[model samples]
Target: MTTCNYAAPPFDHPQADVILRSADRVEFRVFKLFLSLASPFFETLFGLPQAPDGATDQETKDGLAVIVMSEDSKTLDSFFRFCYPSTLADDPSLENLTDGLSLLAAARKYSLDLIEKKVCQALANPKVLEMEPIRYFAIARNARLAHETITAARYTLRQPLIPAQFSEIELITASELLVLLTYHKNCSIAVQPLTKNLKWLTDHYGGCDACIWLFGPYYKGSCGCGQVADNRFSPWGIHPVTWWATYMQEISELLMDRPSGDTVRTAADRTIQQVRSMGCSVCSSTVKENMTEFSNLLALKVDEAVSMIQLEMDF
Candidate 1:
């Protein structure tokens, strides 16, 4: 409490019973009652037997006991805000993922159950989790936040595999990384069968006449454009429309790289071009609507399949 360089506001109440000093020498004059109520750590600390006359060599300033904390001023400021009554805002903005993780660590250290819960909720926010999911996953897994870890891991599937060098990799163990990789691999495997079966595409409707002419063996007449060379084996046990086959091929590759519904939702340029190039004017005129409908169903099916692949987290 030497020369009190900084006193965080809201916590700087003049009538505060104790002064919690940060590692950087900033002081937060907070009420012991609030801290004790919110944290068992503080309760136990204050319950300790006082020195004779309560005057042992514990640091003091202005007649209030000074408790030095290892956290910096900013972190303690956020922690105390949560410990305070509902008069203050319930949630404080943690500037970045690093700050969120720092607050989570501090909350856990102090055994502040409510604050830890709030921090976990904030960390799980989509805006926060989607920005850098792998980093969030590493940090959250290291912190042992099972929900946040799983949420972040799922978000990771929307992007390619984890890069070789990310800053937060040090926070997680090899086993943690392996679990996520396995989950991604499982999701990828799950979606492969989806693309291999054209029955889902044709189940609801008769084959498109344009597709049959341009892609299948029903080539009765041509609209001038030559038929696409669709020699690839069809999962439908019959030749799939060249355009549909191409679309499936591209999306299946995309799903393997990023095993998520999002991968198939955005139709590939190659598939669209292939559709437009079809000899059937009907297929070209209706490609937009048809692809939208098909891709939506495909994306939904991909999500359903991925949802079944459980991410095994060792919480």
Candidate 2:
């Protein structure tokens, strides 16, 4: 074998100079210092690819070509700085409420804090509620703030005062009712007002139809009927006993008949069966553990404080 003295190209070669220059330009455009540092090695390893000879300015700016381009901090910052407010101001598509809602969703999804704030501000405007789905989505997503949103929506809905033929009450949904109930349970004097209202309503109207629907006829009949009365009918012509018996009988037969007993027993049995089927062992265990840990922590804190006070010699 003949020994050949072939030297690798120098850094100052014309090709190497072109590569370094291209890399520098790329780093400048991208405005990423890390990319700038690594550019020399990268350019040496891979030669700069040729751009299309006659590509238009718009084509390059639009970045629609097959070549892979990196979006560095500078480009992104510039793009957003101009594009965001411009899009908000001049975009005809965003004039549609649905588009605004979509933008809100996108802002939320991407964790774009400023964008989300802007979207929320837009939504706060009265004009935004013209989109029903957006209004519903906002209320549904932010359940904690739903009361405020509902109040705002009600105000908006009433403005220009166009009355519809059919009127629907903007009452809380069943889930929201449960949330309100749980919220109330933590407060003192909760049961007093509820009990008082229940009694007042019962005395005045002879029981609520909605309550009857929820708890069944047994609750309705048993609540107020005199001992000697075999049947109970409200002043509103609702036969509590008959309705309860019929509804219970229908349901019982459909899902395995239960023996005639106290409503509480029947309800308890149904609940137990449902809970058992749910396989909530983890939840039960976690709840038990949490309760134990909380009690222990409280006891430990109390003991620690007592010990500290005793050590202070003010006993």
Candidate 3:
């Protein structure tokens, strides 16, 4: 039998006090990693000069501070472990579940690619898997964002599943499923079921842009890549995997019949009156609806429109 040599903390951990006192400082690095991975928030932080390979300890420390001071505590701690592996087993005074989750949330919210990858490795322990939902939520949430590399890493870290007991499979929720699907974009096994579920949503809700964008290719017998694949529909000029949210918005507008000049005027008047009556903010912005909600409303309107048109046809 092959055995694994995992890293563990020593009996007399010398840096325990420094690790605890400066725990918040440790999160700064994690924040930097998160900012680097997410595109929208990337520009907020300024760049730092790289430390020379043969630079003295003081030179390296000074160089790091330029970029490090702007980062938060949660981010700092996450980055610390990656730079110094021995610090992994340091027993910090983790006050509660919230503290741990807050750190994990920062990782996910900022899309800290490297930290997420490492955390997924720690989560592979069976003991960790059996923890409370709060703990599992953190792991699942991050795992959903870490991309395919994390999934591949996890296979080595944990035991394989038994195919015969497929029914006994532990299933993730819709939100969780979305995360997993987003992380492992190329996994056909995972993508197929999600596609099927989205198809059902389309059949029932018809005008839901989110569902349409999510599973449009599959339903239309094309792929998002514009390739004519088996049982997939190509979303022309749309990148299905990345711009799913935007695609749903487009589909919703189409279902709403593009709201003509007359329709827009009527909708605007109604919206103004409704907002005034509620005493809320002015109707400065256009009303936006999710694909699912829009689809439902569209189906009803289509039914009514068809009924009205039938009388004209009959006459």
Candidate 4:
């Protein structure tokens, strides 16, 4: 039960009736009535009768109540700054996402759900999750921000995060962490079959005689049927077949490197670029259409696999 005669922060209103002191002894002289109006939680707290002998309070001077908070002075100032717009000349400084999240936690601790939601919105903007997705995943999951949780989880999937690297595992629920791991496993398994249908482009869509001129006659001579090549024994050009082979290999590599819908699309795009380099009208046009279809199918499969984890998104 120690108390200090500390001066209030610079923004403290002169007519404030309550003093909030952080663990480090910094003081914020904020108004009780304004806080109560903004949050029913504070109103209910203020409605309670004073503790006998002011047991929970550090000290009350000049008829103003002094309530000591467990948060550090920085967090208290940040939290109060958002609650009191008059104290700030600029928009609430929410550049530090972790601090914004911590302020939300403090708000929720005291049932300031209104402010809690505002903080959630603030955290949703900017590069918070991108900065540290695994860490953001842990925080969002704990805060029960379902959309943010899934967004961070998606980013986490792309990272090389190890369980040992996460310092805040205790903040993440076992079930939630299991769900994320399950999502990674399912996506890996789902993308295993993500190979382009080589038969469809090569076999089914065998090139016509004129097609070989554009593709370069990869085969030596025309068959008795007046066709330059059939995909089974002869391809009009090496590029289409080579492209599919390279694409399949890329798919396998991507499956290992986090084969999300977006990553697979990039792989498909690269494959199509290589296919175009062959300058074969038949190969370029056919493969472009087929690759688009394949990418869509693979993306759908990945999304379905993610759905199995049931970590539904909020937006």
Which prediction has the highest lDDT against the true structure? 1
Q: Pick the candidate with the highest TM-score.
A: 1
For model 1, state the Cα shift of residue 155 in Å.
1.4
The TM-score values for the models, in the order shown, are 0.78, 0.24, 0.25, 0.62
Decide which is better by TM-score, 1 or 3: 1
Candidate 2 lDDT by residue in tens digits, 167-242: 1123335454343223222221222232112233355335555334322224434333212222222323334333
lDDT of each: 0.75, 0.32, 0.35, 0.63
| lDDT for each residue of candidate 4 in 148-262, tens digit (9 for 90 to 100) | 7777787765554244466657787677777777767665665554443333334434654433422333323421112323343234334434455556666767766575676
Q: Residues 154-259, candidate 1: write the lDDT tens digits.
A: 8898888755578889888898789999999898998898776666666644665524542433444433334345544354345555666667778878898898
Name the weakest run of 10 consecutive residues (lDDT summed) in model 4.
Answer: 219-228
Q: Tens digit of lDDT per residue, candidate 3, span 13-73? A: 3332111212223312223432343422343443444456677342222133323234445
Deviation in angstroms for 215 in model 3?
A: 57
Q: Pairing residues by index, what is the TM-score of model 4?
A: 0.62
Tell me, what's the RMSD of every candidate?
4.5, 23.3, 22.7, 7.7
